[model samples]
Target: MNTSAPDEGRIDTEVRGHLLLITINRPAKRNGFTPAMYRQLAAAYTRLDDEPALRVGVLMAAGDHFTAGLDLPTFAPLMQRGEQAAPAGGVEPTEPGMAGYRRRQKPVVVAVKGITYTLGIELMLAADVVVAADNCRFSQLEVKRGIMATGGATLRMAERAGAGNALLHLLTGDEFGAAEALRLNFVQKVVPPAQVEQETLQIAEQIAQQAPLAVVATRLNVLKAIEHGPLAAMEEFEATQQRLSRSEDAAEGVRSFVERRPAKFTGR
Candidate 1:
């Protein structure tokens, strides 16, 4: 197992087998993200994508709350200057226009509890799956802060939760409970507060156990359809199939099925 800390320990990362466990550690502030913390968060996600051994990532917070969103005061200067910054070796935290801004090939499972606001919601939208605590409260309250959400919320929220639901919350900046989140399709599962992390890790572990290359390809195809329309995605189907068919793991998968045994994929 390997561990890494970034931005004065604001972000903590631990590797368990093929899963990268990332936790937001500053519960004292309700896990509120300072500009530095945002950079660290971006860096952690980047590490998850860059490391070949890491097949899945679990994002959770150490405290009751996932995050209180951006620390307005700490970020005020950057906001005023209209400057965007991401950590070294990291994708842009808010703006999706940056060259490095792209979704990860591997899956990410998020466990959210307590207050999840603004960027927190965007983070969940970015994740492949979300497990929210029953007590969780969420909002996209950037309009209340006299600013708009810079994260992908504007683009992805409506895609996940429908335009009407996304607009209702984004326009009103009202708080919504976990049940409403699930109803809106914002979260995949809602469990007891204490079970959030366990449930999220369980999902991550399942994804990690899959053939890594095939897993990535599956996610990529879905994203392609979302980003470039189904026709464009279909255009690449044969290419993807041919590529995966050539992988040794694919052959092992077939053999294992024929032998009535569990497949042991090397991610080759």
Candidate 2:
């Protein structure tokens, strides 16, 4: 449950019911990620995707801030050397496509507050859903550091927020508040700081309560639609529906509806 990386930072993981709660625990440095921390986080995500019992993942941070960004002093040299973000034998946390890391099959919900810069923004953008505190501050300051965001920010930001909105922050490297983030469609919900984690956990729990196969399939379909086009995703709808229809969970769903009781899905 307590997975520590090198340096003083660490990633703590806790499985609550069907949810994997991943907390970044390096508050002393505003939760800035070192290489080791990144690897540890990736390992946690790998567990979530590989474990059948784990239906959803909730990513949050300890202390006041989600993260300040990568430990640039340590990372910039690697960047200059033309090295990949994820080192050898480790999965890339932000962008799965980079370095051929296995794409995550599960959904991740992110809860953020205070200063969330650079990789923090990319992390949330890569996730399925996000909950932010009203006082949250976000910035894609990679350009300011004389580097570019390779952590799916350049690709997913425009997809999530419009091109204009994404460029406004990405190009300028200016700080934006939680309200602007909501307007840009970056975060799904904005609540008081005290309620951020609770709200995120509730949403993750809601997703976890659904049939796991259905949830995973739905996410895959939506992502495919985004990437390949709606028609392509729609073409697979019949086949996907038929597959689910044959599942034991589907039978349980029908029985529960007929019996006027809640469905108890075993992810079958």
Candidate 3:
């Protein structure tokens, strides 16, 4: 643990090569987020956004369970005070019960294991890719708790898993195994518990090896397409290509790709 950057009891970050791995470390509590911890996630995402050295970021949890949900006890005070539209320092929490609202640009991969309830289930929708253990359970239990999903889930859940299934899960707040989640596109890949992290990291490593500028531009276009329409996304896509095609890195990518070598991108 780095005493220099102590972050209460929520997250632990380790930078591995060009990949930044942020683990929800309160596994003893099933990785629930404290209000302070919730606030830090957005700050961390902001750091990830500006860091040119990192091409990929990851969000995962330790132990068998991914997360039970927010630390209601710790955050209940904030709730009693009423949820602010955004966090005080402008780093706002991860969109209130939603995941993935704090970040975009770089591709993010989530590795899931064990039980995932509430925010944990919603979190998968936020990542570009998800690799999960076969044994993991997925659920949306906020309705059962007399709460609604405050995360991006309310919007993206139907898009991710089809409206029928999303309604079933959200309305009933039942738990289902990873096989169902995989079938519904909630997770991109499912493997044994032993290989989930390895596979996820490998996927991230491959993403990190691509041309940095092009990668981020691709992410932006894809996210724009998701939020807007294909026509609008296409407009940005053309401009992105036109802008990138003229850069030195563009030529380098082709040269290195043809030479079967790593492209030393200056991010030009």
Q: After superposition, how far is residue 193 of candidate 3 from its true place, in Å?
A: 0.6
**Number of the predicted model whose TM-score against the real structure is largest:** 2
Evaluation by lDDT, superior candidate among 2 and 3: 2
List of clashing residue pairs for candidate 3: 98-151
The better candidate by lDDT, 1 or 3, is: 1
Off by over 4 Å in 3: 1-8, 84-103
| Candidate 2 structure quality by residue, lDDT tens digits, 15-82 | 99999999999888999998777878989988898889999999999889999999998787777898
In order, what lDDT does every prediction score? 0.84, 0.89, 0.76
- Count clashing residue pairs per candidate: 0, 0, 1
Q: In model 2, which range of ten residues has the least summed lDDT? A: 84-93
Model 3 Cα shift for residue 247 (angstroms): 2.1
- Kindly list the per-residue Cα lDDT of model 1 for residues 44-81, writing each as its tens digit: 78888888999998988876799888878888999899
lDDT value, candidate 3, whole model: 0.76
Q: By the lDDT metric, which is better: model 1 or model 2?
A: 2
Model 2 has a clash total of 0
- Count clashing pairs, candidate 3: 1
Could you give me the TM-score of model 3 versus the true structure?
0.89
lDDT for residue 15 in candidate 3, whole number 0-100: 86
